[model samples]
Target: MIAAGTASMGRAATPGPSRWPRAIVRLRLALRSSEAAARGGGGGRWAACFRPAPVAGAAAAAVKEAKGERSAEVEVEPARGGGEDVWSARADAEVAQGGGFPEHLVVMVNGLVGSADDWKFAAEQFVRRMPDKVIVHRSQCNSATQTFDGVDLMGERLANEVLSVVKQRSGVKKISFVAHSLGGLVARYAIGRLYEPNNRRASSAGKSRDDVEHLEGLIAGLEPMNFITFASPHLGSSGNKQARFLLLFYEHMTFKSLPFLCGLPFLERRASETAHLIVGRTGKHLFLTDNDDGRRPLLLRMVDDSGDLQFRSALRSFKRRVAYANANFDHMVGWRTSSIRRQHELPKHRLLVRDEKYPHIVYVEKEVTNNRDTEARADLYDPEEEMIRGLTQVPWERVDVSFQKSTQRLVAHNTIQVKSYWLNSDGADVINHMMDHFIV
Candidate 1:
């Protein structure tokens, strides 16, 4: 029951040229030729080369040949006639229907050091529970490669990846994003890029305005559906007193090798550099500590009025936006940061009650204590303080879930998408609750 286009849970292929069969290569050439012909006034020459007149006995063989030697893991729709790719035709039909696209496209983004495989379990569950038409694509951003790069760079890459996905799945008019941890930030950054307004109204002679308009139309046409994050540090970890030490400890534990002075010497060096950058400028943005320039914190810039208006508009466009916070045993992102609320604002009491509406899930919601009501202490001027004020103004739902002590000990930050946890009763409940947000 794995969703369509879900990447294999094994290692990702190293970035390189894809080895293709002779027939497949020819097929691509034919497609390209057809596309070029379409752009010109001439009719498709390669179309006839690939697809000959249908003869009774040979038609079946032609169909088989067209199927090619594709792997079972990959789903490939047969090329339909009329010199147009099936996806393009489907997209055109969808546009004609005026209902936007009938199919739901869900993109699952993994956190730091996580590959597309991290979402395999969740994708399977989503496919099994959701409608058959839903297609889930697990995004591979800073997974196989270096994740130490800045969030902005990752965000730009993600934006390009998403655009590529959109182009490939032309019929996908609506999209829902499910991101984990740092992936949430990447997703946010991508959406911001997609929603950036065309400030330069007048297009240059070389760059036609129509091109810009078309690109803008394509982005706007993709109706953003649900946006859900698991254990994302929305409010950031910088403000959390415990986060600094935890991050350092986690880094040490991850990279420390007995043979080397600090573990793998090269890895340790990279980790040290990452830690410095993360705790300094990057950490400041994530934690809303220091505004590097006059600009506010990264999160505030993502959704504030003065920041990117189009980004804020795109965020508001989502039908449902939810952040699921781990109440216990999450060392990476704290519950307060995940919930985008202040640390002291959470309810002191821990009440575990099964939701009547969602029987499988147990959750707790705490009323937000407005920090703005309190007088601002006279302190050094920090632009982050202003950003935090703006962030608190924007209201969002936060659900708290706590796991059993044993589960907490075994499965902390990784509990969100791990297959074993999803199989467990409590984990199933959590998954059910998460899926509910995507419904409709």
Candidate 2:
């Protein structure tokens, strides 16, 4: 799942003298300086980095006005040979003057060990396909070595990155998230944080319930649109016996006891005691065994309703919630986990027949299990159903995509993104169709 690192965010303050030696701090600062120079000193702030011009003619004028710019009226050109541009059709519908076409911002988050660069092709395609209607931003704040941090910590950083962008762009009135693999969990936690009321005291103002509500309302006003993920272990890896075993192995080898003896020297950095620290914590969380605080699993807390009004409000505000799972060749995440469904709920087959309309995709509707049914099986706890019962109450549409071994050699975990060769071959259109639900 490791990909090239994109530009890093501003480094956090160095540890105190007791935590780090001056020599190491200096070396780290130098390395960061060179990395910034290579990335063209992009200022390490969350900004709208892509704004492709709208299609030629009247649409151009609309785009300018959409940006709050006044311009002379331009005659719209008729479709040549009575053919419309496929890409232009994907843009937002036109609006009358002063009606104001609210711009939608799509935030794409990469999985563990992945970077913003991984979304380069996907972002470009979205811009090229949707033009002025949508803007895509890739978050690389918690990638690479940084991914070794816990999900809650990463989620806090991502929340800041998103809030920074939202603060900078006043025109953006709606937001959507497209995350992959572990990024989905991070995004979930971040959104929960965003929904919560701001507790920081306002300058020259007293803290009150009204002020807190207003702060939360500001985020809610953004109009969360779509929450989508690809190959995300929503039910987590601990739901199954096999997955649990593998997670146990991974935890012991990386973070539990003998990570150094795992023979993965490349994962160790002198500045950071173990490069695997972040991954180990992440694994433990996913395995539902990282109860350091004596609380429930992180995933459970994420879906719980009591005392999480903000989280429930955020979840209810989203217009759509969807997940894409791989039917085969996805050894990292299983179908049930990625789909957030119970094993007994899905078909007993390895692969279903290809979908007719979306030949590359298979759609699975969530099985609604009645609470009474759960009462009879009290011995077993259905995490999937429990999540649905939570305040978030997500109604997920699980899509399963096929991966042919004869055509592709590697697993499908990483290929869910748009840039994958497998997706580019014939699956791009299908993926685009899936994304259409969020375009408007």
Winning model by TM-score: 2
Q: What is candidate 1's CA lDDT for residue 291? A: 53
User: How would you encode candidate 1's per-residue C-alpha lDDT over 297-394 as one tens digit per residue?
Assistant: 56667655344435555565566667777776565677777776654766454555656664423465533323475456677663435544554553
RMSD of each candidate? Answer: 17.1, 14.3
- TM-scores for candidates 1 onward, in order: 0.61, 0.62
Q: What pairs collide in candidate 2?
A: 148-278, 149-278
The digit string of per-residue lDDT tens for model 2 on 264-342 reads: 2232222122212334567567666667768776777777543653555566546677788876656567777777665
Global lDDT for candidate 1? 0.52
Q: Report lDDT (Cα) of residue 297, candidate 2.
A: 68
